[model samples]
Target: MISTWRRRVAARRAAKKKSIEEDDNANMELTIPNHFRCPISLDLMKDPVTLSTGITYDRESIEKWIEAGNVTCPITKKILRSIEPIPNHAIRQIIQDWCVENRSYGVERIPTPRVPISSHEVKEVLTKIEDAIRRNDDESCLDFVSMIKSLSKESDRNKRCVVSNGAGRVLSAAFDALSKRDPIHEHVALHEEILSMLMISLSSPLDEETRTNLSTSESLHYIVRFLRFGSLSSRRNAVLALKVILSCNDQEVVEDLVKREGLLDALMKLIEEPICPTTTKASLLAMYYILKSSQSNPDKQATISKFLEMGLVQNLLEILVDSERSVCEKALGVLDGICSHREGRNKVSENVLTVPLMVKKMLRVSDLATELSVSILWKLGKDEENGEGTVAIEALQVGAFQKLLLLLQVGCSGTTKEKVTDLLKILNVHRQSVECIDSLDFKNLKRPF
Candidate 1:
């Protein structure tokens, strides 16, 4: 019995020692070898590649460096004879073996990296797509566009490469051709795939030529078609792409775009029944830009009238009642722009919820929201027709009087303070007519105090 007990004690000690050794190994393994890390990122190099300067880096890190217009090596600062980096396969193998050896320490092995698509290759794909588009081969166009979309999704480098290689021109031309030859129902898949590629191309930094190519009236018309009739995914991409394209173009282009039939209705539809928050915000921004661009046009009020006729006032009020801060601010901005015209102000003042909602959002949402709400109220209050203090009466009824006082107390910007003061004077005129609900006892309160 004594011998058996001694043997058991020895076994326990041996097991404990083995665990201690493993703990020590894990601690030591935590310190990665200096040579295994990329010089630029200081992280483990999963796919090491050597520059012409003999300095090695992870493929992604070095590629980004080169793409950023850097012709010199990151570490050595020597001018690169060739920007092309040769794969450091031997170092990658060493790293993989190290990871395997340290598997017990929870080290994960990095898989071999795929070679990035070259500019020449992207150009080749574009050539094929252009050929297919010219031949009116729908199947070939779909296949090649799908291929480009796949490559674009792989990495940002590939996306830049695709765009730099005239992907936008190619895709826009395809859209133009598709619109001319194919009815909307004939090639649904092909149209959607082309839209998908256009969306990807638009995401990259667009050069002047590409922007001009994309912002054409014909292209805008097709995008509007997709925005109205395409699938849910296509609609989302369409609106987002529209926002980018509009932002890049000048006011004349935007003026023409807003005049497109069914454009306003399509945007309002997106706002009313948002597919996603992003699409809703994009729709609002697009409308905002349109209103802004039309300011210098001869028919600015006519444009505002167009929006008011589309029930924009009601939609913006609904958005203000409940939305995130960003969406609320944008909706308020559009409403403010609308109120720049008499028709817009009258439309806004007619809605009972408009004044109340604006007052509620004043101190609650954000400073920008507060500013826009105040601006809209000031426009309504100061209107010659509403100058009879009707707007002030409505505002005072909805507690705008107290909110304006609070805004003054808290302090505000010079411009905001001016608006607030003017609003205070306006609301003050009707303050006497406003009944104090808190002070009145319903049973004892008399009518028309």
Candidate 2:
């Protein structure tokens, strides 16, 4: 009987130990220390940083708060003396230890954060660059620009800091100064570096003053020079910078930019030789904006004639054949703009793959692409009837009628539906000539003949 009583007591002790273990496990799963969590995010701080107000928060959350134009601390409700947040190393270490200990519970340790560049530091670098440019010290100028470029590439915060601190003005000044030096070929490396720095610094949107400063004729002349003669990377940066400058939408600036001799040719070469997809896209966008701006100018036809003479239509048709969706869309957009003119229409109609390629791209790509393709076709066949024109005949031969019928059945925008209806009417005139349309079930088509 005593042994039985002892056994019962032992069993009670074992059960109590198991209960304690289960409670510990549950606690591990449910609890995170309140001190480890950010006041702003209410989540565990990955890069805990202390503000001037002595309150700690995650780096990203607090940076966003400061960037949103807030000057006061969220928790302390006091105005911040400084915007910089000091890293809370001790708390970060504690969090790391906790994460390591609770790793089996799916916790991962945060990486050590890279310190962001301060606006003061960016200004200091700009000062050095200005001084170097003043002294005409090519070596020092290259070093300083390279340093700024490295800092700009470090993080988005650094790029913003560089741009916000008037880097564009300083860099453009340097570029203008260096480009005027005697024996210009000697400073090619410096020019490339400055152009690269300018490209990186201006990656973000600019304020009015900075945009105006960059929009000058002197600045644009240097960029066009580089676009024609600089190395691959330099050429890329030059064109990208040109795009940003043109983005200001200044009419006088756009007119001056397009009239620059060899500018359109340089862009065409970039498209033809194809440095990289990004550079090609930038070139296309630059051309698109130039063409778009010309619509209001008296020199609109003159500009279109220049592009047509450069064989832009053929180049764009080749791009349409197999380019990626976004690229194909852009190429088609440019083509559509060009085709709006009579000469542009003749150039497109002359290309054999124009109709078939346009038809293939209609339903296979995105909605915007479909709209563009349909618009280009409508421009081509809208004037042609009874399959008399090459566009209509080729489109009929390539099953374009069936494609348009299918596009209408699947539904499209109001504009697209109207264009499709017009195209179907044009193609239906030749439907009796083509054998393919006889098999298509037009019974489901909502558009009447």
Clashing pairs in 1: none
Considering every candidate listed, which one attains the maximal TM-score? 1
Give the residue spans of candidate 2 off by over 4 A. 1-32, 40-43, 68-82, 97-110, 203-206, 295-303, 385-387, 399-418, 435-449
Q: In model 1, which regions exceed 4 Å deviation? A: 1-13, 26-29, 63-69, 182-187, 203-208, 215-217, 248-260, 297-306, 384-386, 393-417, 428-449
Model 1 TM-score, 2 decimals? 0.83
**CA lDDT of each prediction against the hidden true structure:** 0.82, 0.85
Give candidate 1's error at residue 261 in angstroms.
3.8
- Residue-by-residue lDDT tens digits, candidate 2, 282-375: 8988888887787666557988999999999999999888889879888988998887877788888888888878877877777899899999
